[model samples]
Target: MSYTVNCSILLTDLPLLERPAAAKAAGFDAVEFWWPFAGSVPGDRDVDAFVGALRDAGVQLTGLNFNAGNMPGGDRGLVSWPARSQEFLDNLDVVAAIGERTGCRAFNALYGNRQDGCTPEEQDELGVQNLVRAGRAVQRIGGTVLLEPVSGADAYPLKTARDALGVIAQVRQNGADNIRLLADFYHLAVNGDDVAAVIENHTAEFGHIQIADAPGRNEPGTGELPLQQWISRSRQLGYSGHVGLEYRASQEDPFAWIAAWAHV
Candidate 1:
């Protein structure tokens, strides 16, 4: 099994454009990231530099998040935020452009937190609409839109495979069959989901898989998640995609644990 480095989390010490080259130097040929810009549409220069970096580093861009507003400020996503519905919609073209350039077809859309004024029904309805739009936009590039269950934010509602899968069903019902689940084991484990059972039963539903250990969102083996076993089980169930290394490195070398799981 090969791994795709999550440049957004694993290489924080480097500048954004430099991380891809660094990932290549660290022996990875593929990478993923959060939306690399603050706004929905970045200037042409910034977009060029980003795509240039990936091409220059010879790394495949595997997955990217849609513009999840103010992630550092606790805004989980904009898909369910009514006020930012247009913002999310505007981002689809940009995302499709990048994916077209980099051959990145998997895009993660973080479902926004529950808002104060919007009823759950309204927010969910809006989320479905936006996701359906996203699904169609990406479909131009033969892409799959991803919905992930996040952890540690009480306001963020999607916390299990079932939660994300439910929304995926709704998106499909609304005429977007390209939506799929992003099975990030760390988040599901932290939220008390049976990660093993999820892998066992839902491997067919996964479009992408990301991982980190529990207790601390650090590299595997720094915590007690039995990550290797779970990874093995995922493969046994026929998941052939690259597993994303999305953990925060606890040591100078983020890939020290890679040696321990060489068989994977």
Candidate 2:
């Protein structure tokens, strides 16, 4: 698997419009990002500007997230909240249009942390309904909808690859087979899963793969996880998707980490 820069975590020192060019300068022709701009749905001008930036930078958008709700404000995601289902659904069209513009074929929809006064059953029901719709939308665009296991610290329900896979299965049962897993190694490692084994055993089931070192969600080689071993093992297992660089850039030039992966 090759690498794709996650601009949301990287190039923070630069403006959003400049990050894709920065990634391109760093030798990455592909990039992915969480929701850009201040809200779930930005204006058409903002969306056009974003797509234009990617095009002007000559970078491919391999993946994108549906509105997860004010990420910096602790809104882990809103896709599963019953009351926010409409907002989530509305955000789908926005992301789908962006995907069409960028030729991106993967969309990740985060299942938010549990909310006050809402039952798990209600959240799950709403989540299924929304994901089914999302799955169908992306399917029309020749894309795959993704579900990822976020950290427990965020109080999010899905905390492991298996957790996301279970939901993927449920989403499939609800009549959307386009749903797949977004396997983030750092979260799985933090949650105490055998990350390497997961890759070796379930690589075929993953739609996207992201990585950061364990103990600290920093760049590869900055923490305890044998990122190279697992990454290399992933390629050996025939997992052909890009291994997204979703880790935080260190104090030093973050682009340097890209070279260190060369020996892997």
Candidate 3:
């Protein structure tokens, strides 16, 4: 099992230039980041510089998130919002170009908002369409798109493995094979689902795994879940992809946590 550090957590404080160097020094094989570009939106960081840093550090760019909510407007998610469709597609192209430059093979293509009036079926259709468009862009660049289900609080959209898998199935049924699922343990735990069982049943559709404890949303050991056992079970299920540590650390120094899980 390969391990990756979520750069959003481990290197949040460091300038983008130093993040990859710090992650490499801390012994991580790969690093992932949330939307490195959001059209100059507030809180959006410089992506080109970040990519340069990763290249210099010799760290693999394993994953990246492309959706970061609509900028200047408060609306989140891109599904079912016809107005944002072109913008979302354009952004996917830019992110895919970045992935090509950084040698990244996977990206998080998030589904946007679930408004109050739309039916579940309608939302599902819209989400599938958007993902297929994004997946095609990724495939053109030799990358895969991982569909991540956001929590209700985060996006009012797909909030469970089942929801994400539903969209992926639809994409495949429509003859699009480039989309896959990103099973996030934190969201599963918060939604009161069985992470181990989900992984077991959906192994075929899953391409990546992310973990942070529920409640506190911190490192694995800090939460009540038996992360070690969960990881062990994942291995048993033949999950060969990298398990990304997407968590906030209680300690100011992220190296301590990395060292603690060095053997994992």
The best candidate in terms of lDDT: 1
Question: Which model, 2 or 3, shows the larger lDDT?
Answer: 2
Off by over 4 Å in 1: none
Q: What's the TM-score of every candidate structure? A: 0.98, 0.96, 0.87
Top candidate (TM-score): 1
Tens digits of per-residue lDDT, candidate 3, 48-78, equal 5777788889899899877656523555456
**Better model by TM-score: candidate 1 vs candidate 2:** 1
Clashes of 3: 2
Predicted structure 1: lDDT: 0.93
TM-score of 1: 0.98
Model 2 / residue 160 / CA error / Å: 1.1
Candidate 2 per-residue C-alpha lDDT over 55-113 given as tens digits, one digit per residue, 9 for 90 to 100 = 99999999999988878778877788877778888888888888888899999899988
Collision count for each candidate, in order:
0, 0, 2
Write one digit per residue (lDDT tens) for candidate 1, span 1-264: 379999989899989999999999989999999999989999999999999999999999999999999988999999999998899999999999999999999999999999998899999999999999999999999999999999999999899999999999999999999998999999999999999999989999989989999889998999999888888888888888889999989988889888877576
Clashing pairs in model 3? 77-112, 78-112
lDDT of 1 at 95: 98
Sorting all predicted structures by TM-score, with the top scorer first, yields 1, 2, 3
